[model samples]
Target: MDTSAAARASVCRLPRSVVTSVHTPVSPVGRHLVLMALCFPSASMCPKGCICQRDPHLHSLNVTCSQSRLKEIPPTLPVDAVLLRLDHNQIGAVPDQAFRGLRVVRELNLSYNAVETLGEGAFIGLEESLQVLDLSHNHITRVHRDVFARLKARVIVDDNPWHCDCALQQAISGMAHNHEAAARVLCRSSDLLDQDGRPFLAVEIDLCNLAKRTTDYAMLVTMFGWFAMVISYVVYYVRQNQEDARRHLEYLKSLPSKPKKPDEADDISTVV
Candidate 1:
């Protein structure tokens, strides 16, 4: 063999152990760093139309994404996220399958959105460990009974259009007994409120003037019926008492008043 080829062969024939020692396997910590960078390109890297940021704490799983024009929820959210903020978006509804794989989510903020209709059974199979649900500032027209039935957390549902009609009676009554429920419900829809600028509470009954009028009319009818019955009973009692007194007076007149004893009758005749 030529001297150059012999030298190249010797260089290529280095001990396998020496090569292995020089090229050790990647450390777990380094692998994790690479994964994070791949998962999130930047510290505040969100989707083109979304605004979001991951938590800096390695032990904490917190993310805040707000003010995005997201028409729906993002699918690939971090599964380990515990505190999530999704505010001021255009999320119209939470489909039943929205939180399918999110097992560790605890506090969720869904405020200042356009959520008009939350579908029935929307939160069917969410993580049982969930707590502190915030649905403040939205276009929710009504609360379905099933919606509350599926949740076991402290619900904050302030500033939504709660139509207090027969459709909401059951839901409102049920909410009354839930200790974890909040007490600040108000109507945010002008169309649902009456001409007055007041909210739709019992004290502000006249705010929904039409509904108030209808309720007053019903109460008036019931009161009139009761008053008529009372009057009829009183008239009957008075007439019966008057008739009894008349009969008693006639009987008194019929009875001989000790019959004016014969001797007393004769004395009265002589004096006359």
Candidate 2:
């Protein structure tokens, strides 16, 4: 029996229960703390490029990441964040379910970005809790019909280049019926030619412009048709007169020459 080797092995090894005690499983509270860290990022988590503070004017947790040129949403934003301002960034699109983690967000400000496409149901999760949504000064020309369906807030959509086409006509007209929603729809697209510069509410113009263009086209066609018809009639009348003169001359030629008098005939024969 190698007593030295046995003693060494016994010293190196411990009971299974003793080893388990040494390395215990993570407790529920520890897990909760880790989740808290992930969910509620404190001052350390906020970026130096942005601001996270409480405003007495808003009376909520305000996070302003405007003009930071950030291309994506801030990571690990506090779940209790109330007012989030992410304006003047280079963000191109709002992915679907992007703000689901912002459960208590009330006023979301995303103005002045290069947003081209807002994903379907992008802001659906914030439907009930959202209070004010500012999407002004972006490159977005048009929004999906249902993008603002669930949002009941002050929506600012100014300074965009709306196309004012057939598809936008119906939706803009429908927005008028809901005056609260309509008033909130501050569509300041240059497509809206209201000189007053107040939030343009002339969805009717978008609808009517199409009809107006169509009627103008029809009028132009009718004028052209009338001009062509008049020219054709004038040409026909002149040619008919020319044909009548030619026929009259031919008829006079077909008739026999007038007979000369006796003296005239005698003179003509003498000359010949």
Candidate 3:
């Protein structure tokens, strides 16, 4: 082989790292740009009117849509988002399975919104990964008992118009990991106005018993209505039968008495 061919063979035999190091070193900024490109979602994937950043420590996406004038949750959200902030928006309600696609979200902030009621399964996909759910300063009035029962996250539900009734009591009591927050829930509305504005847990009334009593009263009223209907029917039947008997007697009286048999009349005249 020629000398030039031999030199090329030697160069090819060098280790891969040595060959790569011979090229110009990439600057820190270039390395950062590469990392961001690899970690962060594309602009098209990010929801409109929102900011999405990658958490270097957590190695996950952090999506923030706070104060974005969102009337409702964006239909499409980055699926890899682990922290979502939607506070200070105009969202009115959380529909069922609202976050179904965001299975990895750990912290969800929905405070300062216009959320009035949480439907069942609103947080369906977050049950396993969700750590903190902030719902403070909303317009919530009532929630289903099963709405928060499955969530193990620390829920913040203060500063809302909660109707502290049996349903509310059950919903609050279902929060196993949020006892302190539950204890701080004040009654915005109650059966008795005196109990309003008081801590729901500190109230003296038994909501379950009250609910039971109310149901019992309703049942009693229904039963009495049925009884009255049956009694009225019996009275109407008796009056109708009496009227029918009187009409039959009047028909019998209207018929003229048959004249005595001719033989009987002749026998009577002969005896006279």
* Among all candidates shown, the one with the greatest lDDT: 3
TM-score computed on alpha carbons, candidate 1: 0.52
Q: Tell me the whole-model lDDT of each prediction, alpha carbons only.
A: 0.63, 0.67, 0.83
Top TM-score model: 3
> For residues 39-87, what per-residue lDDT tens digits would candidate 3 score against the true structure?
3544457889999987655667889999899999888898988999999
List candidate 3 stretches off by more than 4 Å.
1-37, 266-272
Question: Mind sharing the TM-score for model 2?
Answer: 0.51
Per-residue C-alpha lDDT of model 2 across residues 1-272, encoded as one tens digit per residue: 13442342244343444334322265645534433443334556565688887544454567889889898766667566788889889988887877877778988988889887787678867977887877777777666666776676666665665555444454454455356544444443444455233444545455456667877999999999999999999999999999999999999999999877999988989999
Local error of candidate 1 at 98, Å? Answer: 1.7
* Candidate numbers sorted by lDDT from highest down: 3, 2, 1
Candidate 1 regions off by >4 Å? 1-23, 27-58, 174-182, 187-272
> Scored by Cα lDDT, where does model 1 land?
0.63
Looking at model 1, which ten-residue stretch has the lowest summed lDDT? 195-204
